[model samples]
Target: MKKPRNKFFQKNKFDQAMTGYLFLLPALVALLVFLIGPIFYAFYISFFRFSFLEPQNAKFIGFSNYIHLFQDKEFLRALWNTSLYTIVVVPIQTAIALFLALIVNNIRGKTFFRVAYYLPTVTSTVAVSVMFTFIFQPDGILNKFLENFGIHGPNYFNSPTFALPAIMMMAIWSSVGQFMIIYLAGLQDIPEEVYEAAELDGARGFRLLWHVTLPLLKRTTFLNVVMSMIGTFQVFDQAYVISGGNGGPLNSTLTVVLDIFRKGFKTMQMGYASAMAFVLFAIILIFTLIQNYFLGREDK
Candidate 1:
C-alpha cells in the first residue's frame, strides 16, 4: 500500500513538470532559434576562413582572422574612430540631456517642450542622415547661416577634418532628447521634501542642483551613459547613409559596425567581419564593466 502511494506522488510530480515546460516551450524555442543560434553561428564562423559568397570554400583557420584584423589598417582606423566617437559623444550627450531635462522640468507646457525636443529622436536615422547630407554640403543651409555671421563653413562630409565632427554634432543633437526624457523621469522621482529640506539648508539654484539633484540622479546618469556608450559604439546607419557605404572621405566617419558591414557584405569576408564584431563586443563589454564598477560603487 505504501509503495502504491509513493508511485502516485511521483506520477503527479512528473505531470506538473511537463505542464511547466509546455508553458515555456514557445519562448524557449524562439530564444534558441533567434538569439542563441546566431551567436553560436557567428562564433563558429569567427574561427574559420569563411565567406557567404562562396559557402563551400570555408576553411578552419583558428585565430588567423582575428590576428589579421589587428594587422589591418582599415580595421585599426575604424576601431580608433569608434572609440573617439564614443568617448566624445557620451559625456556631451549625457550633459546636454541633463541640462535639457532640468530646463523642461521647470518650464510651463512641458508636454509641448517634450514633444518638440524628442522629435529628432523619433525621426528615422536614415532620413536625418540624408537631410543632414544636404545641409552639410558646401552651399547648404549651415554654410549659408555661417556666411551671414562672416564665417565660412567647410563642406562637411567631403573633408576628413570636418566629416567625423559633422556626424558627431548631428548625433549629439538627435540623441539628446531621448536621454532627456529618461532624465526627466528620474527628476520626477525625487521627493519634493528632499528639495524643501535642502532649501531650508540654504541650497538654491545651482547649489541645490549640484548638491541635491545630481547626487540623487546618479542611477539615471549611469543608465544614460551606458546606453549612449553602446549606441555610439554600434553606430552604423547614419555613417553608412552619410558616407554612402564607402567609409570615406578617407574613412573619417567609419565606425566599427560600418566597417563590419563593409567587410562582411561588400568584401565577402564573413569570418573576418565576425572577428571584428567580437572585438567590438569585447571593447564595449570592457567599457560597460568599468562604468558599472565606478558608477555602481558610487551608488552604493
Candidate 2:
C-alpha cells in the first residue's frame, strides 16, 4: 500500500510540473514572437539590401551591406567618435560615482544627500538635455560665468571640435547620479565589522579606501563600469537634441546609434542599418563579457 501511494505521489509531481509548463507557455510564446523572432529576422535582413521605402523590392546582395559599412567614411567616423566618448565618459562617471558614494556613506544625512543626488536620475532625459543645452550655450550661464573671469567660452554645439566633448560632458552629468546610487547601495552592503577591524590595525582615510573599501566594492565597480559603458555606447538623446538631429557640427557628434538611425530611417536603408545595429550589439556584448570575465577571475 505504501509503494502504491509513493507511485501515486510521483505521478502527481509529474502532473504538477506539466501544469506549470503549460501555464508558462503563453509567456514563452510571446517572448519568442516579439523579441527572439525579430532579432533573428533582423540578422537575416542585415546580409541583404533593402529599403524601407520599398521593402517588397529587397534583393539579396551577399554581405554588400557590411562591405559598404566598412568603406563608409561617415560610419567609421561615428565609430571613432563613439569609442572616444565611451573611453572618456565611462571612467570619469564611474570614478565620480564611486567618490560620491564614499562621501555619502560616511555622512549622517545619508537619506537627504542620496535623495538629492538621485533627483537627476528620476528627471526626464529630454528636459535635462534641453537644460544642459541652454547652460552650454554661448550666452548661457556657463559662458557668462567664464566671461566674469575674463575668459571667452566657445559655442559648444556650434564648433566641430567641441561638439562631441560637449555631448560627453552632458552625458556624464545626467547619468552619474544613478550610478552613484548603485555604488552607495554596494558600499552599504560592506559589513561594519570589516571597517571596525581595519581601524584597529591603524588603517585610515585613503589607505582604508585602497585596501578595504575598494577591494570589497569590486562587484559594484564592475557593475557600474559595464552599465556605464553600455549606456554611453548607446547614447542618442544628448547628441540628437544638442546637434539638432543632424549629428553636427560636421557630424562630430554622430554616435553608432545615431548613424544607425540616419541609415535606417532618413536614408531608408533598413537592411544596412540592421547590420550596423548588429555590429553595435556585438561591440557591447564583447565589452560586457570582458568585464564579467575579469570580475569572475577576481572572485576566484
Candidate 3:
C-alpha cells in the first residue's frame, strides 16, 4: 500500500515541483544577482588588500586580513562590545516581552496596550535613536525628572560608563513589543483544554504558569531568543547615530557592524571590512547553532 502511494507521488510530484521552481525562478535570480552575488564577491575580495580609493592597485594578501583581524585591538574591543550587547539585551528584551504578553493576554483593554507597545517597534530606528539621545541628555526630561529627587544626571552618551547601557535600555524598550506580539500569538494558539486540565489538577498561580504555559511556550521563547540575538549582534544604526558616526565616548558604544562600516566606508579598507563581516557572520552562526542545541532541540 505504501509503495504504491510513494510511486504515485513520485510520478506526479516531480513535474509539479519543477513547475513550482520555474515559477520561483525570477525571485531566485533576484536573490542571486542582488544578495548572493555580492556576498560571494565580498568573500573573494576578503583575500586581497583592497581599498575603495586604490581599487586598481589591490594586492592579494591571502589570510592577512583575517589574521590581523584577530590581533587588532579595536576589532577585539568591538567584538567584545557586540557580544556584551547581545548578552545583556536579548534576555532582558525577551523577559520583558514575555511579562508584558502575560499581562496583556489576560487584561481588559488589551487592544489599547497592544497598539501602544507595538508602536515603537514600527517606528523608525533612527528617529527612536535620536529621541532617546535627547532623553538621555543631561538637561532632558529624564534628567529633569531625576533632578526632582536630588539626583544629578550624567551625560549618558558622552560617558563611557553609561553610553552602552543607555543604548541597551533603548534597545530593550524599542524591541520588546515585537517579541511580546510573538509571545501573544503563541499564547493564543495554546489549546484551552490544556489550561482546563492544569486547573483540574490544582495547578494555580505561578505553579500553573511554570508547569503549563512555560513548557508549551518553549518554541516561542526560542524564536524570540534567536531573532533578538541576531538583531543585537548586528546592532549598528543606534550606535552610529548616538555616537555621531564614530564609536565615541572612549569607544564604549563601538559595535562590530559599526566598526565594519568605519573601515569599509570611512577608512576605505573594503577588504578588511569584508573580513570583519565574515568573522561576524561566523560568530552569529556559532551562537545560533548553540541556541538551537539548547532551545530548539526536540524532546525525546
Candidate 4:
C-alpha cells in the first residue's frame, strides 16, 4: 500500500518557513538601505566632483579624484600614519590580549577578573579619550607621576613626538580586554587531553604554552590580528576627540578615516573623500589578504 501523504505537516513547514523570512525582512531591508546602499552610492559618487555644499553642480571627473589622491601629501601622510599605527598596535595588542587571556584562564575568581578586565572595552571610546586627554596633559597625572622620578612629560596632544605614541597606548589599553575575551574562549576550546598528553611528553609551564597552546590557538591569533589591523587602520574617534578634530600636533594622530571626515564634511570635497574611502578600503583588503596568506600558509 502507498504511504499516506502528510499534507498537514507540509503545510505547517511552509508556513514556518514563510514566518521565518517575514521575521528577517525588517533587518534585511534595513541593512540594504543603510549599509549596502551607502557603499554603492559612495562608489558612484567617487567618479564625479560631487560637492555636498553644491550638490546641484556635481560634475563627472572620471578618475581625477583617485589620481589627485596619490599626489595629495596630506592624504599620503594620513595613509602612512594609519599603516604605521596598524603595524605597531596589532602585534602589541594581540600579545597583550593573549597574555591576559593566559593569565585569566589559569586564575581563580575568573569571573571577577574577567569583568574587571573588560571594563575598558565596555566603556565609551569618547569618554575614554576625554579622560585620557586630561591625564596626558603636560601637568596632568601622567606628567606629575613622571616628575616624581625627575622626568618631565611633554604635552601629549601638542607634541608631535608623543602624540601618536599616546594614541597607540590608548588604543591598545582599550582593545586588549575585548580580544582577551576572545582568546579566553579559544583557550577553553583546547582539549584538556591534548595538554595532558603534552605533559606526559615532559611539557610544562612555558613549554606547554610555547608549543601546544600557541600552535593550537593559531586560528584565534589570526582572527585577532586581522581584527586589530582593521580597527587600527580605521581609527578615528580617539584621534578626532583628542586632537579636537583637526589631527593636530603636526598631524601625528591623523588617520585615514579622520582625513576622509575632514575632506567630506569640513571641506565638502565629497567626491575626493569618497575616492579616499575606496582607497582605504582597497588597502585594508590587500592587508587582510596578505595576512590571510601568511597565516594560512603557516597553518599548513
Candidate 5:
C-alpha cells in the first residue's frame, strides 16, 4: 500500500511538471524565434560578404568585414563620437535624475511632481525629437531666450561643432525623467530611521544626504549609470532626426548604431553592418560587465 501511494505521488509530480512546461512553451518559442534566432543568424551572416540587394550572391569572407571596419575612418569616427556621447550624457543624465529624485521624493506634492517630471518618458520619442529640433533651431525659443539674456545661440543642428553637444543635451532631457522615477523608487526603499538617526547625531541637510542617502542609494546609482551608459551608446533617433538622417554636419552626430543602420539598410553592406553591430554589442557588454563588477564589489 505504501509503495503504491509513493508511485502515485511521483506520477502526479511528473504530470505537474509537464503542465508547467506546456504553459511556458509559447513564451519560450517566441524568445527563440525573435531573440535567440536572430542573434545566431546575424552572427552567421557576419562571416560572409552579404548584401540584402544580392542575398543569393553572398560569399564567405571570414574576418575581412572586421578588418575593413578597423581600417574605415568613418567607423573610427563613429566610435569616437559614440564614446564621447556616452561619457557626457550618462553622467549628466544620472546626476540630473538623482537630483530631481532627491528633491521630488522629499516634497509634499511628490506624486504630482513625479508625474510631471516623468511625462517626457511617456511621450513618443519621435515627438520629443521633433520638439527639441525646433527648440534648438537658430530662430527658436532657445535662441530667443538667450538673446533676451544678451547672448546669441549658434545654429545648433547645422554647426558640426555644436550639433553633437545639442543632441546630447536633448538626450539628457528626454532620458532623465525615466531615471528619476527609478531613483525615486530607490529613495523610497531606504529606511527613514537611518535619516532620523543621522539627524539625532546633528547631521542635517547636505551632510545627511551625503553620508546617509547617497551611500544607501549606491545600488540604484549603479543601475542608473549602467542603463544610461547603454542607452547613450545606442542613441540614434535624436541624431537621425536632428541631423536629417544623414548624421550630418560632417558626421558629428553619427553614432555607431546609426552607422550600422546606414551601412545595413541604406548602403546594403549587410556583412559589414553585421560586424559593426557585433562590435557595438561587444562594447555594451564590456561596459556593462565593468559596471557590474566595480559597482557590485563596492556594494559588498
Candidate 6:
C-alpha cells in the first residue's frame, strides 16, 4: 500500500510539471518566433551584401560590411551623437528623478504629485516631439520667455548646435518621470524601522539620507542608471520625429538606432544595417557587463 501511494505521488508531480510546461509553451513559441528568430536571422544576414528586396542575390561578403561601417563617416557621426546623448542624458535624468522621488515621497498629496509628473511617461512620444518643436521655434513660447530676459533664442530644431541640446532637455523631461516612479517604488519598500535605527545613531537629516537612504537604495540606483543608459542608446523616435526623419541639423540628433533605420529602410542596405545593429547590440552588452561587474560586485 505504501509503495502504491509513493508511485501515485510521483505520477501526480510529473503530471503537474507537464501542465506547467504546457502553459508556458505558447509564450516560449512567441518569443522564439518574434524575438529570437529575427535576432539570429539578422546576424546571419549581416555577412551578406544585398538589398533586402533582392535576397536571392545576396553575396557573402564575410566581415566587409562591418569593415566599411567604420569607414562610413555618417555612421561614425551617428555613433558620436548617440554616445554624447547617453553620457549627458543618463546622469542628469537619473539625478533629477531621484530628487523628485525623495521630495514627493515625504510630501502631502504624494498621489497628486506622482500622477502629475508621470503624465509625460504615458504621453505619446511623437506628440511630445511635435509640441516641443513648436515651443523651440525662434518666435515661440521658449524664445518669447528668453526675450523677456533680453536674449534672443535660435531656431532650436533647425540649428545643429542647439538641436541635440533641445532634444536632450525634452528627453530629460519625458524620461525622468518614469525613473521617478521607479525610485518611488524603491523608497516605499524601505522600512520605517531602518530610519528609526538610523536616527538613534546620531545621524541627522542629510547624514541619515547619505548613510541610510542612499546606501539602501543602491540597487534602485543601479537599475535606474542601466535602464536610462539603454534608453538613451536606443533613442530613435524623438530624434527621428524632431529631426524630420532625416536626422538633420548636421546629424547632431542622428542616434545609432536612427542611422540603422535609415540604412535598412531608406537606403535598402539591409546587410550593412544588420551589421550596425549587431555592433550596437555588442556595445550595449559590453556596457551592461561592465556595469554588472562594478555595481553588482557585492551581490551574493
The TM-scores of all predictions, comma-separated, are 0.92, 0.94, 0.92, 0.95, 0.96, 0.96
**lDDT by candidate, in order shown:** 0.93, 0.91, 0.94, 0.93, 0.91, 0.93
Per-residue CA lDDT of candidate 3, range 1-300, in tens?
899999999978998999999999999999999999999999999999999788899999999999999899889999999989998999899999999999999999999999999999999999999999889998988999999999999999999999999999999999899999999999999999999999999999999999999999999998999999999999998999999988998899999999999999999999999999999999889988997887645654
For residues 1-300, could you state the per-residue lDDT of candidate 1 as single tens digits?
Answer: 999999999999999999999999999999999999998899999998899878899999999999998899999999899989988999999999999999999989999999999999999999999889889999999999999999999989989999998999999988899999999999999999999999999999999999999999998999999999999999998899989998899999898999999999998999989999999999889988998999868767
| Candidate 4 C-alpha lDDT tens digits along 57-128 | 999989999999999989999999998898899999999999999999998998998999899999999999
- Relative to the unseen true structure, what is the C-alpha lDDT of residue 172 in candidate 1, on a scale of 0 to 100? 96
Q: Which candidate is the best by lDDT?
A: 3
Q: After superposition, how far is residue 162 of candidate 2 from its true place, in Å?
A: 1.7
Worst-scoring 10-residue span by lDDT in model 6: 291-300
Q: Pairs clashing in candidate 5?
A: none
Positional deviation of residue 17's Cα in model 1 after best superposition, in angstroms:
7.5
- As for model 3, its CA RMSD to the true structure in angstroms is 3.8
* Better by TM-score, candidate 6 or 1: 6
Q: Candidate 6 lDDT, tens digit per residue, 68-101? A: 9999999999999999999999999999999999
What residue pairs are clashing in model 4?
Answer: none
* Model 6 bad stretches (over 4 Å): 298-300
Query: Which lDDT value does model 5 have at 230?
Result: 83
- CA lDDT, candidate 6, residue 68: 97
Q: After best superposition, candidate 2 residue 223: deviation in angstroms?
A: 0.9
* Clashing pairs for predicted structure model 2, backbone only: none
Residue 292, candidate 6: alpha-carbon lDDT: 88
Report the lDDT tens digits of candidate 2 across residue range 1-300: 799999999999999999999999999999999999999999999987888678789899988888888899999999999999999999999999998998998889999999888898888878988998899899999999999899999998899998888888888887898999999999889999999999999999899999999999988889899899989889888888888777899999999899999998998889999999998999999999988998888888
In candidate 4, where is summed lDDT lowest over 10 consecutive residues? 1-10
The stretch of ten residues in a row with the least summed lDDT in candidate 2 is 237-246
Write the residue-wise lDDT of candidate 5 on 123-234 in tens digits.
8878998998889899999999999889999999999999999888888887799999999999999988888899999999899889999998888998999888889888
